[model samples]
Target: MEQSLYPVEFLHFGIHLKFELTETGIFLKICVVNFSVLGLFFHRPLALNLKAQPGENVTLSCQAPDGVDIEWSRTDLEELQYVFLYRDGHIDSDYQHQSFKNRVELKDKEMKNGNLSVILKNVKEEDSGTYECRFKAAGEGRRKRAFIKTKPISTIQLEVADPDPGELSGCRLNLNSLTGFYFMLEADPEQTLCVD
Candidate 1:
């Protein structure tokens, strides 16, 4: 014969619950608690932030106190694609974008700390945009958008030249970097590289 035992009594500071069992081994119980006390135990969940730099890797992480569902997507597209998703401390699907299929990876697949971080490798200039990370708890949901930009680069050039010594030795002087104009120490303003 099979038997099942369950709680049968629920009691509060001022109230009480009772439990009973039958010959078949079936048991039941009741629970009672102060409304204020239950409310005090309830708490708001924490959210995760995502960030990245261009030509570098970016991770959009979503964390929940109780392993809530997490979804990632881009906002500009008419049809949203699921970059990745997590729930109950596990990856839900293998679905991913073609451009990101091989380059994308998940850091905390175990969801040990409710962390769902999606890492994108070798970010490109086109990837400089916004990303969305959403979390769903029961029937409630919240979302966050992160903007990514490209890293800074330095560009420089150098050149050497030799002009006619006869043209450079006279009183006339030339400054070629900013423009093709020239100036003379003893010449009038009109004679100094004037258009007329």
Candidate 2:
């Protein structure tokens, strides 16, 4: 009598296992595999659109569950660049991009509450781009050398524009009436207001 069982693959908790049965004997193989199946449980990145005037400051907010590792990066660049990184309860600046070196600040104390917002000072036209805020669980096993769980939790699209003389006149204008209006009121009104 001869019988063969087709190879079967099983995946659990980021681990992968394979089993095969042949007439001679049963064979088993186990290997670590990085799979996109892990992404099923993670929340999709939230999209935010923001605008700032040149030389102003802007804050990008990213909300995550407490105790998770957070990483902020600029995704619209030619090369992926880290704007800021927070892991294991502390900020890691070694990987921060040179452009963001002195311009980015994180709300470290609010991290305990699952807030990982960053402030970008002296916003300029060059700062306009897509920014990604990612998060990973803190206790991913150190033994796994190839798997990474970092997933984007937020995506911010920032636009920096030169202040318009008439628009900055402190008049209460309806945003609904103005098509494509993007600036948010979070900076010093005096500095943002344009004097003719």
What TM-score, to 2 decimals, does candidate 2 have? 0.59
* Per-residue C-alpha lDDT of model 2 across residues 62-86, encoded as one tens digit per residue: 8766666667888764443478877
- Supply candidate 1's per-residue lDDT for 188: 40
How close is every model to the real structure, measured as TM-score?
A: 0.40, 0.59
Clashes of each: 10, 0
